[model samples]
Target: MTFRKLMIAGAAVALLAVGATAAMAQTSAQKALIDAAKSQGTVGEQADGYVGVRTNADAELRAAVDATNNGRRAVYARSATEAGTTTEIAAARMFETQLLARVSSGQWYRNAAGQWVQR
Candidate 1:
């Protein structure tokens, strides 16, 4: 990545970690839903810092993901505004630069090319 991209990615990661302190907490059930989806390779984290369902999901699963992504977006938007960057930039940097590296095996993720990948 270019220098500017690297800087933005670093800022995004830092902001995410810091912002987690004030963000809405996820319920245990919601955490379980995400865990199951990751284990099942049905839902994955996208490069834009949102959750993506790679396959058909029941209503409950979809709802859970939607809620999670909405919360995440709110955090990203706040961070982006504070940093004087667009929300998409913050989100792209957050997930692509940090979250992707932490995804465990058997989980799905969207690559930089926007392809769904198993890692």
Candidate 2:
């Protein structure tokens, strides 16, 4: 494969490696809270709150992708590369940049600019 393709593959592997180490290791407090929510039928209620969070994150990612496409179209749209390299690469780069930069100590919320923030 090409160098860029190899780099992308390596990056993907690295991301998965790091994510594997990510503390899905829940604290007892957090696990207990989730359990209580599930038992109390509060999952639905909490989901109601999370619906906005989910929707907003999806919207932000979509917008970032769309914006990246528009920008790439004006620039590398004619470049002789992979079919989606211009747009998808840009979006993925943006997202990876965001993910690396935003995550911090025990953080759990998206900030106003769509970046992850500690809550």
Candidate 3:
């Protein structure tokens, strides 16, 4: 792999390790809501390292998305600072490596081009 690819891969592995701990920061209820929304195709991972609502979202779903994105922003900010990179780059990397890879079959995710596609 190219040096850039290698760096990203390494960072991805690091992020994955960090993710397990970070996930514990979220409540079980929050994770359940997001997972349910994802499974139902109402919410999806976005290229910006945030969750997007793909269809009409109820108040509860919207709140859950907002909470999840807020947590993601904090993680990306910390990761960027540690890596000496911008938050956007850190988030994009996480999206490419972590979020995309986590998408279950038949779930939806928004691509870098802002298009929603099902896996």
lDDT score for residue 51 of model 3:
95
Q: Least accurate stretch of 10 residues (summed lDDT) in model 2?
A: 43-52
Regions more than 4 Å wrong, model 3: 1-10
**What lDDT would candidate 3 get against the real structure?**
0.83
Estimate, for each residue in 34-118, the C-alpha lDDT of model 1 and write its tens digit. Answer: 8798889989999888889999999989888988887787778877776678889888888866678878988899877889988
Candidate 2: segments with Cα more than 4 A from true spot: 25-52, 55-119
Per-residue lDDT of 62-114 in model 3, one digit per residue for the tens?
A: 98888877777777777766666677888899998778999999999999999
**Every model's TM-score:** 0.85, 0.26, 0.87
Would you list the rank order by TM-score, best first? 3, 1, 2
Give the Å shift of residue 81 in candidate 3. Answer: 0.6
Candidate that scores best on TM-score: 3
For candidate 3, the TM-score is 0.87
Model 2 gets an lDDT of 0.37
lDDT of 1: 0.80
